[model samples]
Target: MDSAGGTLYLKDEDIKLVINPGSIEEGKKIQISLENIWDKTSDPVLNKFETIVSPTVRCGPPGTVFKKHCILSFPYNAVNEEWWEFTLLVKENFQDEWRRIKLGSDDKDIHFYLHNGQCVVNLIHFTNVTLLGYTINIMKAARRVKFGVFGKHSLNKYQLRVRTWNSESNMEVTEDAKLFGEKLVEMATHIDLLYEDLVVRVQDVNNGWQISEASKTQTFSADDLWTKIPWRVFKFTRSDPPSDVLEATISSSQATNVFQLKISCETRQENIRSKVHFWYFISALTVVVIGLIIAWTFDNFQAFLTSHSGIALFLSGLIVALITYSIMWKLVKSATPAQIVACVFLNMSLYYLGVWMCFGFVHPLTTVNIIIILSVYIIAFLVAVVLFGEIVLKFVPFIGLLGSVIFIKLMS
Candidate 1:
């Protein structure tokens, strides 16, 4: 062989050859020759021979900081029958001189050792290792690395491992690594299914608060995947009403996860018209009962007139004026408090006079007197029903007793 740019010939029986390109300096000429040694009992050494078989390295998803186990397999045919020693080297893409990776139990990350004719390593805490003389922060940008597997018989193979953030396996590795990728895809599919099955519901505990029914019980699907649910505001008339705390729970029929949220509900408005009607009925019933009691107590007018003629004449005239005013108010269709009171008084007074004429003027204990009292009571009840609607008619007896007490106090 010439020291510089020379060609060499090899025989078919040759087992090994070594070339040193660095020894040939620039502008130098040298010739080389080889001679075979014929030893009687010594076997031929094939330490310089290169093995064609390469070791396979399988890793998990790339670009992930999470710890993962990587498998390394060496072909059984490539290994020596007795024993074989090899060194694994790794370096970042932009780095020079691959660093020797230690093989022992003391390593916390990136550990590789032979096990059952294959290399196994846990790259859980693996990071780019800095060269002893270099000062650059290579680990920060080290996403890819070149690994070298070297054997004693000059057998070596260099492979590249690229870090990826996705579950896709870019390297042609072991069957186990492919299965791990499939599992990642399956987990993601399940999460998507659970999200599609989620259901949301909103309830109105207070009827006074007005909320749109369309906003309640909203359903979400995978198409509307949201990290945060949309906020729904309560609407009301006049002013913002008092709020009640509301709870929202989100659960999927197919998932075990449960999420909860809280909402505030504004108070509802009151029905003013209904309230006013209720009070008006009470006032009308009170007036009716008071008028009936006054009429009943003054039925024996002649006896009272004889004792206190001046007072009896004044009260009798006042009662007559009130009855006339009540009749006129009703004809005008005026629904003022005073008008209602007057109408109630007139109706009860007319009933009382009819009863007094039939019963008090004759024998009070007779069957005809009892019949007249019953008929007067029936007529008074009918009048009350017409004036206040049936809601107040049921309380007539109670109202009468209450009004009688008030009338007695006034008379005294």
Candidate 2:
């Protein structure tokens, strides 16, 4: 047996044969083997010389079809002597049944039909007899390939999977292929998803903190033979736990492939509450500073100021409470409308306190005293306007009210 040329020769005691290479490809190896015949139903003499030729062929990759042709040959004497018959069988795998290559009318005795008896049975006109080897064409099928991120979390872990299936059916088929490598992080800290020619940004939406430049991204490619998509790991700052929703954008060149993933952050409530409390304390300190400045500058009017100290202290406390509530409302995510109303009421009280203090300090109406009192009033008004612009307008009504009260009290 010649493996590369698909030729065979048998000169054993029981058989004398020769197989010539027909249309077999040059330098291509075809597998050949012999088997014993045990079935009594078959002809004993003909079955003794049976031989099998097996060759493994592949249809080109993913989306193509290819055809291959070959031929088998035998000794011319075997046909004339009638000692045995040859059977040519081909199969793709051991589990499949062998397909017989049928004999065609092209088979003829080269010596008897052309040169007459001048050539003996062994000395045929043609060196070897030929049989048509079956021609098989295989078509490669196309499949739909899908890639996506399966699961992701703030822990900086992501799982990715790729699936391929026949475009016309729901069944999934395996493909022995690979996906190209890509860099998901550019310049280290910025995590990005680039797929199908589009780039999507992964953002830390829950916590207000931006992803730090020192953070790193890790990627894991799929180990499965079929799925080759890569998963990305993004490390965000964990000093403050993530917010209620952690979001990232997934986009592709095609608009239909764009989507977003939102994951819940279970550990964010405590962090939010702490921030609210901290801002509230800051607002309270701001109010106390304003109150002390007012008290210290009015030392010359201590006797008169002491008489109204009760109202002054009550108004100062009201201003502090309003400032704290407003700050908390802005900082806390769970604040209610009732808390907003309370903040508004406290702001109105602060405005009234500003008007009352303005009148109390300017009552004597001396030029020197007016300069000092007006300067303090201007400073407090600017602070309120800068820090709490939304509630600062409540002081407008107090301006008119103060005028009426001061005129009546001083004239009477």
Candidate 3:
């Protein structure tokens, strides 16, 4: 963060992120990343699209919403399939459903456009989003079906929630609570019969699940789903797991087909915490403990390093630390996760190597002396961070000016 906000030139992602100044104050680090989801999972949602035109770019931490939109730009090659000419941006977040985001719609929070081959978007939030292509006919005609079955129960009312939408694709759809309930019975993909003016009719419910008297003969119109996935909850009295839930018949005015749903999921609930505070607590405690240990033994380490050879040996760690920090700087500028991880491990190894050198070459090892050596190495690591980062410059405001004239003389 800087006075006028900051821009991340994510060269590897071929994306740049611009943060509004007031959103984050000066001298704070913002961690954001883009991941290619294609390599990660065999997402069933991807199959529903005509073709995925671009690799899914996941800007993380997942599900982060911003007060104001950030500028997200992708290079020409980022989504440059031949199908891109007829593509739509399909976005998914922590929310399970994938929705279509239209192109060149100025009012949309997720609008994107191709300008001289570069796709630029106003990123309103962090989510996994990809450019998805649809057939020209499918784009011209929105006649597809996305259907699901969700389990529900309240006292004796054992229920099966049948949800349906136009299914061509949707945005502005709220997550269905029944499908993601405290006791969710995951159903396999629902059978769909694509037709205009379709109606879902419940013919029968048997084999341990009986249709409640109120819903047995009633029919549900697809017109109700035009605006959203209207929940058509049908309550059925049940005896534990049902061998058959319902025999649903989907019909248009003059045609029909039987769509049966049966999946024996032992009703389960996924209890996932969206945010983690445990690691942050552990990290803070470790830093405080390390600081206290260093303060306790730093005097002895200072006394031993008063001579020329000892000073030379101590300064030698700086050369290695400086090189490691430079590599980390480059990796972070581009935001390559794997390389950044490797760089951090290498830096830690080098930090420990300094303590080893102190024990091996200059002094006899003891628990008391080892703590002193560790403290010296820790201080050296902190000095490297101050030199290589903008932290000191931001606080002092004129550190560069003051240090330039006296750096060489001070080092000597």
lDDT of 3 at 380: 51
Worst 10 residues of 3 by lDDT: 267-276
Quick one: best TM-score, which candidate?
A: 3
lDDT of 1: 0.33
How do all models score by TM-score?
A: 0.17, 0.27, 0.30
Tens digits of per-residue lDDT for model 2, 1-412: 3323332323221112232443234554434432222221221122211311111111111111112222222222111212222333333333444444343223232211212201112211212222111112101111122333332222222222222111111111112222222111111111221112322345444453234443332223212211122334343433244244434443322234344444333323344455445555554555445545544554354664566644654565556555655554453443333444355444544554454454565554455644554455556555665687424433422332333233324422
lDDT of 1 by residue, 1-412 (tens): 2223332322421211222343344555444332221221121111222111122121212222322332222321222322333444443322234455544546554565555533444444222221111112211211111111111100011111111111111132223334433111101111212223345544433432334566444444422221111121222211123232222222222244334333332211122234434444555456555655565565564555454442543344345434543343333221333444445555555533433433342434456644655466556656775677534433533443343334333443
lDDT of 3: 0.45
On a 0 to 1 TM-score scale, where does candidate 2 land against the true structure? 0.27
Better of 1 and 3 by TM-score: 3
Candidate 3: C-alpha RMSD to true structure equals 24.9
The candidate, 1 or 2, that scores higher on TM-score is: 2
Q: Once superposed on the true structure, which residue ranges of model 2 sit more than 4 Å away at CA?
A: 1-196, 199-262, 266-272, 286-294, 299-301, 309-311, 314-316, 319-331, 335-350, 353-412
Clashing pairs in 3: none
